[model samples]
Target: MVNAHQTFVIVGGGLAGAKAAQALRAEGFTGRVILIGDEPAPPYERPALSKKFLLGKEERESLFVHEPAWYARHEVELHLGQSVTELDRAARTLTLSDGTRVHYDKLLLATGAEPHRLDIPGTGLAGVYHLRRLTHAELLRGVLATLGRENGRLLIAGAGWIGLEVAAAAREYGAEVTVVEAAPSPLHQVLGPELGEVFTDLHREHGVLFHFGARLTEITGQDGMVLAALTDDGDEHPAHAVLSAIGAAPRTALAQSAGLAVLPTQRGGGIRTDAALRTSDPGIWACGDVAAAEHPLYGTHLRVEHWANALHSGPAAARSMLGREVVYDRVPYFFSDQYDLGMEYSGHAPPGSYDQVICRGDVARRTFVAFWLKEGRVLAGMNVNVWDVVEDIQRLIRTGRPVDTAALADPGTDLASLAAPAD
Candidate 1:
């Protein structure tokens, strides 16, 4: 029995869940489908939340992946503001927080992650904040409005994309933002030293403070609101508010409660899944930040918390659940635009994983492209103010092409002609 009319239930109605429902219908699956989410709004893009959205450049509606009317036309039921409290994998039933049960032949778990909290004191104070959703940005905006042109202070904990982006956004608000990172440089774990130095200089030039190799000791407060935070270096910095952008963990309690085999998170804790994006229980499928899928590019299973990866991962899992043989093989890419400067990277080139770091143009002027080469193959590249070379590098990374870094740095070289032979 093919179960063509069987119900397909997708949990966590973010970009992943929304797209899965759309792709399933587009692929001509005449099955009963429902999308569940804890939020009251339609699934929307999140990358813009910390950058363009927070900067007040884009309206909320423009961030949505698809319009609500499209879903209506397709007849996909969206359960907004509804939380799935329990999942009975054997029975394929999902229990909502309001005591309603949803049954499905195939279950997709796109439940994303939550902001990592600071264990320091004064964490519950009012002035402190973390940016994850559009609501979070609006709340921060409200706080900034009251402190307009005052000696405002924002202490951002963690040096990840969210933290750095928030730092840039906070500075734009004229908030004296100080970023505290335990690591020596921003994006050290992801981009390594040379490229991270570029980010450090860029942010400092934008009037943002950086506290590298520092740890949070305690967050001081008064009147139940935040005031300042003391660091392990025996220094106290006054702050109007504190934000813990430390990172996030996969929201996997429901899956764990339902007896699903969640994967081990080496970088941080997150739910694990097989190559097909299936949990230990075959009836259940997971994707996005929640399910840790084996990364063919990274050579280990990882939970990619990026908008592009989440979008592709969601539909890939959905298609697999529909008994289609499509595998989600994404290039694992993410971008950050801070202060009119654009930075993009693809794939995680291992530490010293490459034999060469070639630069075209000037690094001091911040107008150059850096390439990562392993043996004779181009693994990755970082470009700033150099779109031409970045595009050429992107193509090679995707195709696993070999190239001569020395020739790439030559100003007169036509990179397209020098690209490695296609395998």
Candidate 2:
């Protein structure tokens, strides 16, 4: 049982930390809650930074997880722009960057992740940028605005989700966009080659250029400003500005320094946690992108960086902190918006785990639902330009029963009926 007077210290003021604080209050915990974030801004949504926010379709104020007034009303202490430099877990204390010491009865590490930096030369050039925060997005937005319509050449590194989304935004803004990806196809690792081709076609139709299976040998710049990117194939792609859309690495220095058990780098670098979101230490917990939590459904540890996982895992972590018998078994789900395409995916199946992909609807028209099946069992499902079926897809995965491919592919077959016992 948690004492009402004990202070709860939450590190990392991202969406997870903010949601945990909200959950603490909602769960009737009256203790002092101190949320620490290194950034100057309050906790805000990050997904939009690469999409609507970057394109200026969403306002800055709309990004916040909760308004400033909400924090004040909830009595949650906001420690903005201060980073915890030293965490003495045994002493139950934290030393901030400004030499302030804070004591906590319970600690939650929501350190999230940092954008993976490219070690290639010329990355420090003036027009070279990476997006991970609101400020980064703001800067990119400014660069895009200054470039005007078809006046700027934008070179993007990596074909991951972030890189692809930013490419869409840059192209939409009329910038000449070129994406260089190390993989053979954009999103091939996640969506598989066939489905991945759908996005490749979408981008090509929008005038976005792609260089697949290419390596970025170097970024060339003049007068400390980006000018072009050199590829291993001895080709140079000229650009006025560049954005590194390569993925992110989990921020686990705090947990590592504090003597917590973290997953090996090969297994996915993150603080190791059980199904309840509890770290190796009894008094400490970790969630969001920083936690590699075991999932009952998959029987494996997964560290998901999507928005939905952070939104749900934070609250579940808080409940577990209060000694509740909670299991963080929620199905992992993520969505992306690029060009005229909107896709939602649920479930976790490692690459090569699924034997076949069963599709419903029309793939040529780019309106369809694709299921990753292993031995006739649905391992995961993705809906593209399709609506009102995510719940059914998740249900099919949760049930863990072999599904009839014929029924699954039949457009007339109701999704809910697919979950029924095999006849």
Largest TM-score belongs to which candidate? 2
Candidate 2 lDDT trough over 10 residues, lowest sum: 1-10
Model 1: per-residue Cα lDDT over 185-288, one tens digit each: 99877776767888889889988888999989898888888889999999888898888888888898888888777765565556677777877777888888
TM-score of each: 0.93, 0.98
Where in model 1 is the C-alpha error above 4 Å? 1-4, 350-356, 388-391, 398-402, 418-423
* lDDT score, candidate 1, position 247: 85
Q: Give the C-alpha lDDT of model 1.
A: 0.81
Q: What is the lDDT of residue 381 in candidate 1?
A: 74
Clashes of 1: 1
Per-residue lDDT of 27 in model 1: 82
